[model samples]
Target chain A: MRHLVITIGCEYGAKGNAIGRKIAEDLNIKFYNRDLVDEIIEEVGIPKEIMEKVEEGGTIAGKGAEGDVRGSFSKYADLTDRAIHVQKQIIRKLAEKESCVIIGRSADYILKDTKDIDLLRAFIYAPDEVRIHNIMESHNLSEKDAKILLLEKDKRYHKRHLALTGSNRGDRHNRDILMNSSYLGIEGTAEYLEELIRRKFGSEEE
Target chain B: MRHLVITIGCEYGAKGNAIGRKIAEDLNIKFYNRDLVDEIIEEVGIPKEIMEKVEEGGTIAGKGAEGDVRGSFSKYADLTDRAIHVQKQIIRKLAEKESCVIIGRSADYILKDTKDIDLLRAFIYAPDEVRIHNIMESHNLSEKDAKILLLEKDKRYHKRHLALTGSNRGDRHNRDILMNSSYLGIEGTAEYLEELIRRKFGSEEE
Candidate 1:
């Protein structure tokens, strides 16, 4: 059987990680989230703090140190780019090895050019109102704050992802399944995706 | 309270009609499918046969009369376009008065420009496998036939809709929700959309 890899890109507050984790559990395959990628990056000697900060919407501008920080800006940008490149390399290597579910880090685009493996790309998203409600409850945030945070984070992630992948997150052509998880619930969404993946490759499974 | 309308564009065999019917029933509003449009077209002096044939994919050419009937193609096309325009006018008038769920007929794009009405555009689609299964069971068709019919019908609808609306059905920006109802039974899908609509305009309801 060919190696089957599922790549899931999600909108912020869409419970994408929860859905991806559930799919991996149901399929009995490994799942890779950002934390897993962080571990891989740390193993290569990149500071965990720098990776975490980058993950949290890039390095903060040095406090009132504007003119003094132009050099650091370029340095931070290069480190972030390097981090993304290494993550993509890790994603490609993982897909070549076995069946797994990968969440984010543009795994879909990284594997877009692969020919030998079975790749299923999905993007999970939700309406803004539902997303805001989820974020507000999960983070103990007010509705206004939740809305602002979700938008800001999504913008940053989208720009970074576009820069790295040369593709948009929710482009339908690149996806086998583009769905709103807001209505499907986490388990329902995961189970449906499992069925789709199984149906796509089940004939070849031993 | 502001007027609200939900426009659903769906791939063939996606059970979009069932979902839309349920939503209208739950919300106590009218549901307009092709039949409703046909009635309006017939009232305008177009033959029911032409409208029905157009609805059934623009009239298949008679087996032996292909060349003999080539001249009628433009006539049929003109009638079909007229039917669609009248349907859009009806859709706009309906939105002007009350909240309702409309299925197909490019209602999403027809109502796309209304500023006073709260329009929620959704595209309901399923993976090819699940859709084929639905079509086979519902139409008592062979799998191969079902697949062909689905593909052909979806292509036709997509082309006609694009020409009428200047928008693609599943484009994310054109839709507030793009969901797969393949796993979420019709009821689950309807209930979720109901919640979304309620959250959007419920504050102004008396």
Candidate 2:
């Protein structure tokens, strides 16, 4: 079988990582999510959460709060610029290395022009109510708090995508599929996608 | 089997009607497309193309173009207001009566709150290159004209959808499934969806 790469972009609390991880496990392929981001974050000298904000072009509040606002903003720019470069290289390398499921970080856009690998780009999302409920249960937060948190992170997700790939995160053009998890739940969604990928780009062997 | 309503919203050249019609045929259900719109257009007393413009809140270019612009605009508003009411009523009545696949005219949104029918909402789209290619061959236009026509109609599709649904047509929340036809091609896409719908909401019989 040809090398296949599935890149997933999703809404906050949609369990995108959970879905990707499941597909990867079922297919017995490498799954890249935080480990990929953390590697880039290590280079940027910031935590994963902080990287989302910095990558969205937001200034780090600590050093810039009192003085040298421009300096701090550019400092972020430098970090993000470096991270973006490292991101593409790493994404391409990973896809070349093996068939894998990649979650976010614009893997679809980065690999858009690559000729050899089989690519399945998908976006997973759900209605706000389903997402809010997932967030509340998973994070041990109230419904109201989950709503607030969901909105905050969802914005940065789009901003971060736009920063890296010039295309809107939710744009249909970016994905081969966009699925809502409300009806099927995570396991079902993962199973459905696995079947789809196998049929679309499955191996010759059993 | 319970009555199932699959409402599909799609880009112009995605062959969504073909996909929906195939699913309905396979499932042995009613397929709705231009027939539903033609019914309303007869009442609107305008061509289908003109209705696309008018429903997007653009005034008719005739009957009051010179003397009474407001009159023409309000007349359209009245016609659209009437159309909107009829559109929803007809959509609900058809869905309530039988299992069907309804294409475009914001059928998904119109059926959003309907309680009785089992609804599967999908949005079909493809990359611009693929869509442009499809439109060129199907519409007998040059590549350049097809490109221009594609953009023009795509914008009006979204606008007409928003005017009726109060939600962006591409919003993931509005759909249970969004499939891109570029990868699978129309027949494969229809087959995939038929399998998916059957697995998810299939009848008790074989």
Candidate 3:
């Protein structure tokens, strides 16, 4: 009686990607995080440089360097838009076919219109100072550089999300919950969310 | 190793008050909601009509009544401002002495600077339609009236919060989590929150 699907939109150093994967493992569901970028790259033939920029959590606001995308502003925007649409199709199919946890890529917003599937959308964020320290440790960057990187990633995330979904991630109108990763850490958060999701969509006989 | 203190900020009709009280019960901690207002009224000698107005979640932007507090706008504003000061004192005292769950009145922000205690702040909100329907059913009002009431309460909550704390409740830099009550209902939400609170503040040996 459970068709549980969860989408996690997260800040850069919040470790939402790790939390989502842990939840999927605990629930024995399919986990789709980086595999998404791979699928879009394979299916849509998104340029490698563009995908690499995306991996760096950057917006396509600047110039692109080579042959495929032509480096024009409008064309770069167009390619990113096209990639978002393809990502949407891939997300919808995954939700419709099986239970999975999707990390970012606006999957929560993408699957919001469905009624038959049990979907739980959560955004994981920690304090800026905590996230900054995390990025410093993980990326071997200075405090100044980590702060700059965090802002850049956040801006790019919002820009891409707004273009595709007409809203940002924290637009909680359709989202189910928001969690701060600091209090529970990745494992504890996954444990709590797993229980919460089960309670939300579990069989009535319980 | 637990010095438990929780503060709940909520949108109208989200049942955050109920959730807070239930968490207190489950945790066997002190519950502070209306009592905070009553204490402010007693300690500050705040006028009855204004407290009633405050009870209705209305800002002190307008006039007051006769006798104890002059019916002038300035006097009315002065009284409520003084009451908020008393309320802050009461909140700090409670957090210092005992474990408790406080509802609204910006207790979360009031206690944000402390380090001697364990604290978890949560805001509860529901979908507009669900909350509006709840308002209509509970207050016996038309949908239009219910929507108006909801907006008024939210505005006053923010206005009072800003005037007191220089920030609003949904401000997440200091708050811990936000939960939507529609999917879990009050009891279910309370149950999860009880477990979450214990996990957040319990002994390290666990």
Candidate 4:
């Protein structure tokens, strides 16, 4: 079998991207995040508006803004459904090609049935205060704006996950590892997770 | 409120002692393990033969054994009630003194009724191969003897835990952290558990 497939799911600005990037770099494997969004749009010819809505946690109506487009727009405009399908495709393709680190999009459930995929699924999160501070520092947003944005992003992600998989995004039942970035910090959490993976699947240095 | 009373339960040679020791050391708290056995012997003055049998997984009869006996006595005896009571007394005394780490002896169910006790329970375990190797190295025993010793020890511990609590020993349902020491070596497991305890207690270190 090939190397393990590590999937990280997290709220935005929870340092999921940084952790994924670090794991990919350390293991010398490919990393996918927003880059998969482009591939998805290219393959399905999804419009920019729908892509933005889906990425930001909104649904795209197929037609007439009501219920006319469920089966018409090639893959439909239900953003959550479309996102799930696109992510599944990407994960399948990645599995066929090589093992790598994938961030978000319910990859844990997506690749649940695949073989030789030692899926190390992790849920990354920080407290509200830590998340708000992170948003303010990274996006140069006001305190009120950061809090509002964080709350909305959290809601959307939760909604999208529920709509896609009938479960809460941060539920421990769905994850192999539930880590608080606020406690371990980004580097420490990543190193700890790396050690676990290495121990499960032999050290890379070995 | 007092500091948390942490209990770690695991099969023999599962690194529970090492993890408990590290957590106690790092938090600058007292830890009770085999020392608990000593305390029980001193307080109850149970005979050495009975103590050996009880420690090795035999139980006293419900009818004949006296609550107190001293020195060497080879006669068969029942000290189950006394043993249970003494163990509970030690746990209560420890709780009264300070927050500390207690290894085994059904501390979870013992301290289950106490308020303001942040009980961080953990189950530490490893693969059979890893555990067997550990036993050999630690006890300087041959492979065959080590395997037999490990099997008997595991059975004894399991039965003792079940006898006391009416539940399986080291079950994750009763634990806050279900850790595999096989993945994280002794030091790494301790570090991870310390991080978990800090999070559970809402320590300011974060």
Candidate 5:
């Protein structure tokens, strides 16, 4: 009774979102990523303004810029916390229902304890230089600016992982597979992961 | 009874050799890389010339350039095969005797089945751009030339891995830790591996 469920955690610029998207399409399953934010909004009634802000380098934990749209940092923190809690519930419910690929939001840690489904937890990472180059090309930023934003985003991702799982993201023991996406490129990595999943869980349609 | 034995396999220009050197210095353990060639020569009675040629991409498997130095392709292949077989034995004996770090020559695959030591199998890699940048800077080669060499080296390495292990090196399941050395720089990767070794085998003296 091993249903296929994949959770992917990735460093910024690792093309994890692209890989997850491809895997979801290949598997013919639902893909959850930033769309989970909307689901959280629907499930928990978190305001869209705060969710958007939180999505854009705005941390719920009293640690972002000082452009308060709604209220104090603590208020947003509470809302963000509540939103994440609801997001976890929605992720679990989705996994229980059918096969799907979930990216980020500490979904690997969230689903680690589930027993009913076969879980493939993967962590994708790339070199800083490659990621910085990617950000510069994609975001129309200078080298210095891209480096700064990439590092900040990495810090925020790490903080979020710790906040969610009480453990660092680079801990290899926690992952079923750890890959360097820069070596394989986005599409190559997607193909690699697809083959890996098929090998581990068998090539059965969901 | 856990002796720290690390096998570091890396892509060209990933600075894996530098990291292995620093780890050897830091841990005060024997570091084996090309030195394995010497060991193989001594243990297997292979000629120094053939071993050196094989080490320098002159695979006796008829895959390399046509430069007949000593004998026919089949004879050199037989010697190279014997050298690798003897090298594997030497690697295991070294691990059984003392803590050490070995780089490349598929040490990860060789010592994987060892029963007495704590093995930390790591694969260090970097994006083509970053590795090409590194090669250009270090080897004083043009970017075009550096890229050519890097790809050729990667192809040779992949071929050797397939020859030795009968499996593709990029398979993530083969490694315990996969890191992008370009992200951490050479010294930083060294420090990272140092910390990882300490965590796995404790910080006590060997």
Candidate 6:
């Protein structure tokens, strides 16, 4: 089967992963997110804990632990870089092998040159009120705590995007569509994306 | 009283003039077009023959028989430029005194700096098929003749826009809204414009 890559991008609690999963289910395609984490760990030989920390955007040893001059500092840095490199290779490999939906890791920029790839890049966003409510319900946190966590996660994602792509977090211009999830709610948004994908590829499939 | 500049832009046979007249009536404003020729004869002190020669883009005199050498040797070369400049000043003066809708003098760009001006720039367009039908009904022309006339008019308008504004004719990034008059028809488009103007300024007038 030919491959189609769908990238779901958003800040935390904006339902990027959930949307990607729904699209994959509707299309009957494999979806990859944290599942790639294990493949990355095995390939890079990095410790699972370190991989998880980096994946969640925790600072590496030197940056986080103020002046911890350990002898194995270089080793930790190499492992982190290698793990990232392996994850990117796996993503490319999956795209080559079959149709799949990828949630983040800057998939849009990574596969910019590949042909016959229906690269549907979407930005999912919600107003602050709706986002805060979603976070509270999902995490079972107090309003204040949810707000704090949401803000921090947003910042971390923004920083991660900048670090990975050296550009703004969202590709507003390159994206085929920009969705305000508030307009459609979660399930509606997924259905909308499915329709868009079908419109783009339906004729080709026939 | 404030002057409202209404720019009637279209790709020939697009009913720009008709739409402009309707807008003027809806707001009890004076409309300008070929009727401006009579006004210019009175205001600019130019002879009626000279106005006619330049009415539909006559050339200035001495450029060639095809050109008008009087001003720039192109048909309507002398009159079109004079009309634009005179219309600009008249629009400014009229705006100072009362609200009015000035049509098809590139009024949007001309009145860019005027205060208390609610500039409504509109582009009216009809598909070729619709334009041909309208011309056939209004002018008693054959389909082929009407099509030729429409094409020529479109070209003239395009050249006029470039000459006046250094931009393609009816390219409406400058306009607030673009309406397909084919769908709205003449009266409906006018009513819609009236509703829009009322929505924008109704409460302020109150």
True contacts kept of each: 0.11, 0.81, 0.70, 0.05, 0.11, 0.00
DockQ class, candidate 4:
incorrect
Better of 3 and 6 by DockQ: 3
Candidate 2 lDDT over A1-206, as tens digits, reads 35888899889899999999999898888888956756755664555655655556434444555576687767865666766677777788888888888898888888888888888988899889999999999999998899999999888777778777888888888788999987788998999887787678765532
lDDT of 2: 0.79
Q: Candidate 3 at residue A145, lDDT?
A: 100
C-alpha positional error of residue B17 in candidate 6 after TM-score superposition, expressed in Å: 22
Best-matching candidate per DockQ = 2
**Ten-residue region with minimum lDDT total, candidate 5 chain A:** A56-65
* Better-scoring candidate (lDDT), 3 or 4: 3
Sorted by TM-score (best first), the order is: 2, 3, 1, 4, 5, 6
TM-score of the B chain in each candidate versus the native B chain: 0.80, 0.84, 0.79, 0.83, 0.82, 0.76
Q: What is the C-alpha lDDT of each candidate?
A: 0.74, 0.79, 0.78, 0.70, 0.74, 0.65
C-alpha RMSD over true interface residues, each candidate = 7.1, 0.9, 1.1, 6.4, 13.5, 11.7
Best lDDT among the predictions, by candidate number: 2
Kindly report the docking quality category of candidate 1.
Answer: incorrect
What's the best-to-worst order under DockQ? 2, 3, 1, 4, 5, 6
Q: What DockQ number belongs to candidate 6?
A: 0.03
Q: Give the TM-score of candidate 1.
A: 0.56
For all candidates, the clash counts are: 0, 0, 0, 2, 0, 22
User: Which of candidates 2 and 4 reaches a greater lDDT?
Assistant: 2
Across residues A1-206, which tens digit of lDDT does each residue of candidate 4 receive?
A: 56678888887777888988888888888788866745665577656565556654434442425666546654554445665566568677775567788888777777767776666777677667778888999999999999999988888888767656677676544565556576567776777678768756777532
Candidate 1 Cα misplacement greater than 4 A, ranges: A48-81, A203-206, B1-105, B108-169, B173-206
Candidate 4 vs candidate 6: which has greater lDDT?
4
What would the per-residue lDDT of candidate 6 be over residues B119-197, giving only the tens digit for each residue?
6666667667888898888899999999999988777666555655766655433554455675447886677666556
Candidate with more favorable, higher DockQ: 1 or 2: 2
Better candidate by TM-score, 2 or 6: 2
Q: Candidate 2: which docking quality band?
A: medium
lDDT tens readout by residue for model 3, A24-70 = 88777889896664665566676666555544333355545433455
